[model samples]
Target: MSKKTLLSEIKEKIDQLVNAGFNNPTQIAKRIHRDLSIDETERTINHTRGTVKYHIHQSKKRKSNPALAQACQERGINFDNVGIAWNKDKHWSIQFRPSETGPTFEEMLQDHIDAIKNHNFKYEKIRRQNYSLPCLLVIDPADIHVGKLASSFETGEDYNTQIAVQRVKEGVDGILQKASGFNIEKIVFVAGNDILHIDTPKRVTTSGTPQDTDGMWYDNFLIAKRLYVDILDKLVKIADVHVMYNPSNHDYTNGFFLADAIKSWYRTCKNISFDVSIAHRKYFKYGTSLIGTTHGDGAKQQDLPLLMAQESKKMWSDTKHRYVYIHHIHHKVSKDYHGVTVEALRSPSSADSWHHRNGYQHSPKAIEGFVHSKDNGQIARFTHLF
Candidate 1:
């Protein structure tokens, strides 16, 4: 058998010491000196700790990564069983592994980004005359949860992508019907109150937590964007549409993607505007009312009214009525504080098995909307029950 290289032997000793719990650099250096008789400088060891660990992790990962394993095999070495030890003596001993594995998720995402920039995908929004109305209609498709599956056998209700889509459409129609007598000039459509049931392709939230979902994440994403675009397109004919994105706990990353997709869809349209900023608290001024929207999953309820006032002081001073809209609780609750009304909007989503089993059963299945007048602030509230 060929004798082990000096760097390999050093790396092996370090790994043994590390596995034996010699974590601190001082401790590791002492152990190396004792075991291998190598005068490894303490400061050098300290600096090298991160690199060593990273290489060790990479080595472990390479085993599971078929291409990496195959490349190491071709080199008469196993990257899985041995970590790469870099020093002044050698650099880039190995780069990519050779195998027939497909492109990574990151590679696919980058390709998609490149495609967007090159206009391989077409996006266009209509620009219409600024037909202002006396009142601004606000809808909270809040907690829409587009790809959630709930069987009546479990939750006493049946829900899926189709039901979620239909409910939002019907609820908005109901709100329009109720406001038929009012002259509305603009609409504010707040997206991303858990608009997606999960954030990842693996049916999980942004934090890598799993969720019960109705369909694949891509399917859900398309379904969500389709619903938002459909509703906004319908409303644009009657009034100018102001779109706001409020990222939530469930789909932080993908929700932003969905929001941006909607913005891109209406990018060129004059009748539609967007607040696609990834702000936790977004403020919009319509007529005499100053309105703020958030996901409600973060921050204390009491702090929000004050936050709204402090964050949008100029708007607060200019408007007679101040209100904050919140979602995530999936039910309506209102509180008045220091001249502001902070209210949580209701959602039309039926309870999934988790919610049903947990006794989160009393929330009314409905969607809510608000009417803000040019001078009087919120004049009416519309609720469409499931």
Candidate 2:
């Protein structure tokens, strides 16, 4: 057999494994290695992971877009045999060749947009019954990672879209239940900050490198959008809702999409408001207490307070009690920067293989919230650990 023919065979196997959602190089190698070992005719071949990666590149083909793989998977269609090309103009589309009759990337994109467009949110005008002490209920759903996947064997913890959704639901329920006694006047629903597991259709971060994902980007976006809707519905019944979005490292672009969609969803709802702009740093005022939120990927911990003051001078001066909520580090961190309090919220998200293998483990998965009083400021705190 010619060397070129052998290379072609190896490339074909790589394409098959990649289209089946084996993105990691090591995982792909193991997958194809088993294939070579099982087939009697190919039993004599000795190939490593590095060689497989080389063949993938040499074949002038890359891994199939996760979005296309997911759409095909849903329809019980194998994307391995389908011809796909990556179009980067808009939101990374998988342009398919005319031969295979399948869902076009454009159609999938339109499906999500249509879902957002046709959403009819029936917001019943809800007014809180007989309130007493006034306080702000800040529910920070830190690092939700809605579509993240974690293997128990690889990460020592099991997590997926279902687990993520469950944890968020459980966490939010616990916080609200615990805060039931407080006369919460304002519900500050702090969101974004990596609520999604992936930004691009290629299952990568904003920087364009592949990452482990539980589902397709569009599917996950819809799920997360629904989750936020349910959450806001509950919160609005309690008090006026104020939605804020802080762009995160993983899903900055998609996060904005979710945030804006929520804003549009609550357009008719009088009590609901939004701070869903592109700024990574965002500020909110609850009487005298000033609050700032950011994804915490760009700036240093110590620098946040200074940045906050510099960015919003008028708010910093007017408010007596100033606090900043930063998310990215998946554990609890509280540091008093003298006049300003800089804190990082804890995450309920279980680490994936990459995080677990690299000692990114933090135990006692939980959600945290704080109650800020007008006169006293941050008078109470709540945490629900899973």
Candidate 3:
């Protein structure tokens, strides 16, 4: 690229950053580092800061450089990707790119305001036969916490057994509504770990202190099994179902329990298919795509991607793309790592005051959703349902 062209590109990137709502120099520096893979040395960091300052200074001056000024006027750049690197307090850096990739900040902001509108518009545009494809519904009924008293930690308002069941049923209904709207032909029900309150037969507090329950552990198990069966039967009526029972920290025996029940149930009901296993494991074919799911309790949060990568390498070497969907965090996080997409699905429960007390919050209300594979199974897109 010529010097003039290069300067124009950099100027456009800076302008984009400013327009994307990034004003801090440190943020701009980080974006540059990510986009260009620039070294984070003092010199390079200082250079990025100086570049942003100079551009702003020039724009304020209304300089005679017509090319630079014109590039700034176009202002087609998006700065949401811009980021900053900080060291302690004194040192800082900025990074940004010249063009928009993925969704722009403004687009995302607007999406939050009118998700249904945006979704409808996009759906209408792509509703033609050529784009119509069979969608898969991945249902995750996570952390039921049966037999536990619902306190402030679980919900903003105190919930008795009846209220909790009602809330769960509402979530299930919402999921079914969303799935019906989509052209979904199959359902992957991932029964998350912690299907019960206590991990073992012993009663316990939320913090795992020893306690007692009114009924036997077997009673709790039966209650959980009955509820799950009811939910599965309802879903099977809507679509062909494949249930994956993942054992969790609270209910270490849930996987085995679900597996046995499903095995016996399948003998009686020929329509609903079933696949059950322990959590934190390998991939399975959902359609033409390979999907890996877990309850997300085995490894540290930061190490999950590495664990999934190693597992996917061995289990899905032939697959074009690999996805690992996890529950437990009760928040949504989608990121690409080591040629695999890792997604943390949000929970449908309103009871999560512990998260609120810790100062964590996000919009559209935390929901349960599914990952739809696209690009001939090379990419996965998460669509929030409930």
> Which of candidates 2 and 3 is the stronger one according to TM-score?
2
Assess every candidate by TM-score: 0.69, 0.72, 0.54
lDDT of 2: 0.80
Model 1: residues with Cα > 4 Å off, grouped in runs:
1-133
Tens digit of per-residue lDDT, candidate 2, span 156-177 = 7899988988888889999999
Best by lDDT: 2
Question: What local lDDT does model 2 show for residue 110?
Answer: 51
- Candidate 2's TM-score: 0.72
lDDT of 1 by residue, 1-386 (tens): 12245456657776787678754434454555566554455334433443454445454466466554675678898564543432232554444333222334453354335324534333244454554557889988789898888998878889999999999999999988988778877889888889998877667788887777886676577678778878987888777888888999999988888788777766667778899888899999987899999999998889998898889989988998989999999887899998889999888888888888899976888988899998889999999998
Question: Model 1: which residue pairs collide?
Answer: 125-269, 126-269, 127-269, 127-270, 133-185
Model 1 residue 28 lDDT score = 56
lDDT of model 3 at position 42: 29
- Collision count for each candidate, in order: 5, 0, 18
Q: Between candidates 2 and 3, name the one with more favorable lDDT.
A: 2
How many clashes does the backbone of model 1 have? 5
